[model samples]
Target: MSDEQIDLLFHAAVELQQRGMWEQALTQQREAEGLLRGQPSGARRDERLAALLYGTGGSLNALGRHAESAGVLEESLARYTELGAAPTLIADVRMRRAVALAATGRGASAVIEADAAVRTHLDVGRPSDLARVLQLNADVLADHGDPDLAVASADRCLRILLQPGRPGAADARYLFLAARRASDLHAAAGRPDPALAAAEIAWTSGREQGFAMPSDGLRMVVRLRESGDLRTADRFLKELRGLVPDADPASYPTPEPSVTLAQAMAATGATGVPALDPRDAEAPFVPSQRSAAPFLATAHATALSAVCLSALPEDVPHGVRLGLEAHYLFAYASEAQDSDLRYRFVTHGALWARVLLALTLALRPGDPALADDLTGWARAVVARLPPTTAEAVEIIAAWIPFLDAQDA
Candidate 1:
């Protein structure tokens, strides 16, 4: 293919991928591949082929076709290895392959690949590439339920990223992920104070950089709820909702499962308060429109609204419940990381929301399996929070009694 044609295909593939038309992006990439195959082999030809394969793999991954992504990325890795490509280039492909493996549920294999990539980047003296590998390594570790190691890897990356003259945005991103993993580890270990501190750092850094990611703030709210400081937690929740207006409810990303459990606690009045109207919940706490009013005075009004609304009775309109759940999920999912917390929170929240909707609006108690599924989800959320959110834990604790009584 002509250089001009390859360039056009590459650009087209990138645009399609960005637009979330992954299938179309893959199609464009395949066309580029076919064009390249017709050309004579040379150094430049190999480089173009590598680029096409890498781009194709990325698009396939974006489309959730992980196996296909792994195949394409493997091809790219082989070509890069053959060319004796620069350290960063090889490290990048290794990172991509590791991610594809993790996505395909090969966590142990992913960790091995990611570790090698991290070592390669470190050896090559590329701090940025090292940071990326560390982040990906943390992800794989977390997925494998090794929170301590995940936190350690993330913390190491954060240390490097916070050094003098580091790139601001990327540094902020690393700090955010590191804080998130640390908070999760703290929570799992029943250390609330450290979790709270880590969450605060994550939120502050993200906000300072105008990161607009919600997962960090969502984690903070969960930790605060666990600490029995509902008032303070409300403030963070308000900020979370305000930061992500375009976030989709069903697939919103959260930093951890504790955040979703907190939302669920609010929904059931287990937090020892009445739930507020989801719409009005965020409305009262909007930080951008400050006044002398207590709710209006804070920087994150939207989250406060969520806390208030979640405390309300389940008898509220189905649409209102769904909206509240959506907001909660959206806030939780807003973080940029692909950690276990993000996955669990989004998946659990989606399942819980559906169950609530079905019970309150569509199905009867006699509906086979619905109640069981809902109960199972509630238990999962409760199991995830750390001891720091004592209020949240107590709320869930009380729920067990309540549910027991109802069952009796």
Candidate 2:
């Protein structure tokens, strides 16, 4: 109950949180809060309370209690606003609150909060702050269905971050985010060059920052495919698979089978060029084999697979076709989860591969029914995909007719 005891508890809570013991951390945080509440009111009371609320809210968010986390963040935001803290502090609280709101399905409210945070950062007139604001704005714009604006915001952020003397971690993060937005925008605009360039920048920056998300690698492969660099894309896919293994069959949120199917197809066209061993690369983050849940593991694996498949040769072998079919069956047999659905729908890596394969078969100068099968699969998957995934799927689907015409 003493001040010393409270400090000790707070430090312990932080350590626990860092160790991935969310529940224990939350318990310790709550204990610390209770100790603080029992003390008399004073000048530092509000500050102490704000810290406690912020920590509690952050822990709750990590534990997937979005609604509760939002409540705590809302309280923290109110207190930070009353204190008239520096723009940086206020912006941080607002950003956290916006994330919580988004997690709870309050998309419109989240965007408003994020926009306000961006405005506050801009008002502060710091290049770093401005870069952060632009990145946040990019995310909000992407959510709002304005890919062009999102890409522009990210580009602006990246320009600032790339300037000399900026913080390395912050610059890397902004550049990575910008690359992602640019890639998506280029793909949507049907421009392969810009997308490939953006993807390469993002992948290189992310690797340098020790951030090895599956999405980063997948984006690179996708852009390479779009640019007709199948050989490089295929090599990249093999490296990704080695980084993240396939998920177990009994996991709750399994990835779509289509991803593995696509990878199998792509591998067939690999030039067998010896790639630089990832272990030898001076990457900031070395990819590890931590046993994360089925959802994350599967989704990451699928993303890599999808990109690989998308980069396959036009005339793939029958053996590869058989392997793809088997992988597809495996994906289907896996339990359907949100991660799987999102990967399938939003990334559309699998759909792209299937469509490409169908197109290849149909336009073979003597083949038929390729369009029908592709259309049928696209329709079925499109109906089940979320809005984020819908746009990518639609774009790939639109290419089907052109492929058919080529055959005719």
Candidate 3:
């Protein structure tokens, strides 16, 4: 009976590991493993042994003992098979084992196990768990000396996550976690734009919950790519090699974001697109004036899910005249030859383009009315203006993706 106390200790160890207390978690895990080994050999004892082994193996992995974790996890897997563990548990074990194997330099074996683990997850895994397993598969593939396979795995994970309802995954937090991995993979694969978009989404979501992202390196990479200054980027990378060769630990006051959580969350649903800077003192998306009618009514009527985007209305209020007033500011500025407004458009084109894409996603491929209406409205407006102006040309270019999808 004394050995049964290992179960409680094992659970606590897992909790500590999750909280990033690796050393304490490892100690508790070893204690649990030792106590379980003292138990009499029986059906219940075998099940406890399986669980304790799994916990200890996981703790080892958390503490970066890849080879040891792999051995312990393999033993746990055998005990799980012997005890006939549920499919989910079996799949979860495979996922962690794959990670350990990859870290231990057993690339081929790791990939095999990862693929099997994903298959198992697809059959019975919740979206939250599935996203994590997919990310693990991607990371292992990356370390397996096959960048292509790694990129493919990462892309697959994004597809699964952004699969309409699945993108909502478990919650905003989980979605961002998956998105962050997706961002890194995309960036590594020479796709900076998508990487930047993914990072922005993750950062935005996390910031809404007071979570700060260490995205200094990511931002620099993206800016370097945009500037197309390869030599400068290369030189910067070289400088980074020894800049932090040695460091001293220091403590400072907890930092605060430029915008508050409530403000950031509010901006998530707004149509006003602002240039993204982590330290920008101004709110990004609050329009100077509010419209009397809803613009995303059609999207709301269709199948829409996710955080703030899910809270729109199904239709414009009966008598309200919806208008794309926010979008017209650029056109009006160009027409009036307003230098300041034109400068904003030139400087923030990318963010505005991203906003347009976000808006376009609300259009369901199966339903074309909204897209048709938007296209025709833009066409009509541009027809009345000087089409050769840079603003006019750029605006149309921004809409090309949505228009092409409609044509298809």
- lDDT digits (tens) for residues 208-314 of candidate 1: 87763655556777888777898887775665677765433234333443222234444444432223321121211111111222222121223333443453334
lDDT of 1 at 344: 48
Model 1, residue 214: distance off in Å is 5.4
On the 0 to 100 scale, the lDDT of residue 82 in model 2 is 80
> How high is the lDDT of residue 75 in model 1?
87
In order, candidate lDDTs are 0.58, 0.58, 0.53
* Segments of candidate 1 deviating more than 4 angstroms: 15-24, 170-174, 205-216, 225-231, 234-408
CA-only RMSD, every prediction? 18.6, 18.8, 21.6
Clashes of each: 27, 4, 0
Clash count, predicted structure 1: 27
| Per-prediction TM-score | 0.54, 0.54, 0.50
For TM-score, candidate 1 versus 3, the one ahead is: 1
Error of 3 at 27 (Å): 1.7
Model 2 regions more than 4 Å off: 17-21, 170-174, 234-408
- Candidate 3 C-alpha lDDT tens digits along 360-401: 344435324433544544444433434355765676576666
